[model samples]
Target: MSLGDEPGYGDAPRGEDGGYGGTGQTRTRLPDRAGDVYGGARRGRSSSRSLVTVVGVVVLLIAAIAFANRGDDESAPGTGDSDKTKTAPTAASGEQPVQSTAGGIPAGFAHTGQGAQSAAANYAVALGSAEMFNKSKRDAILTAVIIPSRVAEFESSLDKAYTPGFNKNVGLNEDGSTPQGYTFVSRTTPIGTKLTSSSADHATVEVWCSGLLGLAGDNSTNPVTNGWFTITMKLEWTSGDWKIVTHSQKDGPTPVPGDDRASSADDMAKAVEEYGGFTYAR
Candidate 1:
């Protein structure tokens, strides 16, 4: 399958200061063939290997589901005077907002449920970002947003996923570079966030997001296209901040595609270059 063909795969926005942004730029039109944009020429992988890869991904997802349900019995909602009331998830927090960052990624989230939601939303943007395709920036993002224990694992997984062939498939060079004259667009916009569960030390949050991916240029095979997905992150309060422990995504609660005229490659490229992404707050 092409990168765009991957069921839950999505992209994040490039920020003004070369960081990942919270909101993805809106695409006014749909591509004629979204799959052609990301999954065009195949890099020669054998059918057998491709089948193995698919099986591996399925196994991993099954394991993730089992892990997510592991503590369900023990984590039932509490109802007693001694138990603290679980705050309902909201789109924004009325409390003072977090204002600090590490490596340009949001940091210093409060210990409240709202803070966990914010962290999840921002982390979703970071994970889906174009920066994740670059080795150095990808490492920095992993260190900044993920818990120390899982940083190495996340880095390795991403490195494997964004291989040279995959880079080429996305219209990037082997080293994750944009070819001259072409603009690479990969951005994710979070619609909202929800706190599935939270505690003083641990939290689970889900971010609903839409993204733009592909390349734009004259005669470019892959024109910018949009996608929707939901990212679920498990967070832990550590080192005075909320850090990601685990994350998984699923195909979205997407709406019907609208009837809008697709923009030209030049127009899409110009829009990406001129527009800047936002720093998300919840």
Candidate 2:
């Protein structure tokens, strides 16, 4: 979501500022038919079709095996560079993890691929938080996570993103305050992180995340809803910590949504209040 903008719930707000921090509407679909949409009994034709499908699959499997083995005799294992095999990339190494925090954000990550992944995941949460709308907290987060030189430029860009009109559109006052009797909800949950590239001083990582945004109140136009996205951060090792040099986000590697009943505004507000956020790690 925009640093200061609020997402419009039901109707689009007047002006160009209606959209908040990349938040969008989620459409719900109903099932096409009642129970037993597929009949219990299968006809003879269907059974024949299934048998043919299985036979075709078996044929393909046999052909694939033959193809894989055709050139095995020409190139034996360990014929290539032994060093390449020893240093081949792996998902995990079972190394002791670096776990620490600065200003509530995960810090003290090891200067390794895994450490870069951990830093990116935590930075995504900090950047996507509702606190970003508040100037002081936003500055604090930026200062903690961002590179020393780029902090000013990033803060200026974010200030423009969170305009007064945007705040009003998302059911908040111009100053980013929740309206009377309403609870503003904006949260980001990072599901996982991947290390795209890394070096001695620089690293790039992507964090897959789902976020909740909007307002909760009686007759509230925008209710809290979830959206999936991925955040990529370029980090540099500076001052003994991994600091964000740049960051961007895009629409997700989202999964197909499951059927679930939507909760009432009151329930949503209560849940946001009761549930605490997390500090993520890889």
Candidate 3:
């Protein structure tokens, strides 16, 4: 229980910048343990109170309220003339990319509309990262993306949510460590982002994300699976950057699953080891 010390729950593990390591770093080797902070893992999505976590009530509230306001269109965030609400091109928009990062999370976004969307998209990646299952790393990520005033509340809620039972359900040991001989994989890749509503200082964004979660190992009950979901983040421009005010997630505008060969546990483990997650952009 000391400040600036390792092995304590209260500590924010620092990087070379004295901040959390950015997600931009790729995995090159397996750690001694699969559950250490940084990357990889999946617990199948379940609804038991013990495993239902992240935003909880807030998530339900936002998912209910935001989509209600936007209408029930599964294909788009808003219902409008087909011409007006068409999906934007996915190529880079030529806007200024975030020039800096905090704890490996992209930061210093523009204060414009594009910036808010970028912030929400990138923030979604960080929030859904594998590191989230680790307490110290989770707190560091909350500090990096959440508005300063609400970090404690987020920490408190998620702390209760990522309980020992939850860990076990996710195929990890009670202490949240990946069991030996298995690779845990949890990752979120933002497919697209939509600006739901916006103003000069406050903005709401919807990020369509594809996620992978579950333990990847032969004979593993929790084999890695992919899911489609959308996360809505309420963001505010503050302290010269965009930070999340509140957010929630709901099952997706999921597409029809295509016929594709599944990878073996060994291959899945190797892919997770070699592939690197990107720092998302608009």
Candidate 4:
């Protein structure tokens, strides 16, 4: 790679000064990928990746080491007392309005409020999914969840991340293959969702989620990865439903974990392969 060359990683997060941050920038005079001075960054990514994996595995272990801790009741389905208090719709016509659609994914949802929150929660699940790392599978995900207009952009951007070298770097087979005996698990559980603001045709939704990522196998570079973050989605109303338009992420309102016995990688992988995801509502 050229010293001044910046390898694009899709839409790199814009820094506070309105320029993209990270080792990928060329104007910043950052150390090159192969430079000894930049070695620390490579180490940091490796360490952070490993930490995410350990955290994911440790969460399972914690289930067995139960102890009392006080926190908000987050497992509930809806946003708040008012939402939980609403009755479920009995018919399709009774469903809420459309906000936005890219290809088929929900985008720019109605500012009706609830739909945006719902979209954020759902989108976080889709983006954090194991399938998002595979092109064909990711296409299926985009078809199932993304808004119609933005589908092409999402596909094009993510294709770079799921490149053959990227797959190999993440410990998957070069063809994005999962090892026969190994189970690859990735999932996101929404802790809660809230509507930050809304209008008749647009709304901003925020979802606090916990995610897990990793492959199950001995000597795996990509063990399970875990992280807690809040995803904010901007939605619009279109046709007769809500849809997602823009999305962003931040660290979290993370909580301390309790002690628990962690499960073996094999068991975690097996459970992931056997279990399926659900369409979340809030």
lDDT agreement with native, every candidate: 0.80, 0.78, 0.82, 0.67
Candidate 4's displacement at residue 218, Å, is 2.9
lDDT of 3 by residue, 34-93 (tens): 666423232222466335655587789998789656545554555454433344355456
Best by TM-score: 3
CA shift of 161, model 3, Å: 0.8
Give the Cα error of residue 68 in candidate 1, in Å.
Answer: 39
Q: Model 2 off-target regions past 4 Å?
A: 1-99
Q: Which ten residues in a row have the lowest lDDT in candidate 3?
A: 1-10
Best-to-worst ranking by lDDT: 3, 1, 2, 4
Among all candidates shown, the one with the greatest lDDT: 3
Query: How much lDDT does candidate 2 score?
Result: 0.78
| Model 3: colliding residue pairs | 20-103, 21-103, 22-103, 22-104, 40-184, 41-184, 41-185, 41-186, 42-214
Q: Taking the candidates one at a time, how many backbone clashes does each contain?
A: 5, 3, 9, 44
lDDT of 3 at 221: 88
lDDT by residue for model 2 (1-282), tens? 212222232333444444433355433333345663323222233476679989999999999788657645555676654433334443334444456777787778788777788778778888888888788899999999999999999999999988899888877889988889999998999887778888999999988899999999999988788999999899999998899999999998887554356788999999999999875656
Q: Which scores better on lDDT, 1 or 3?
A: 3
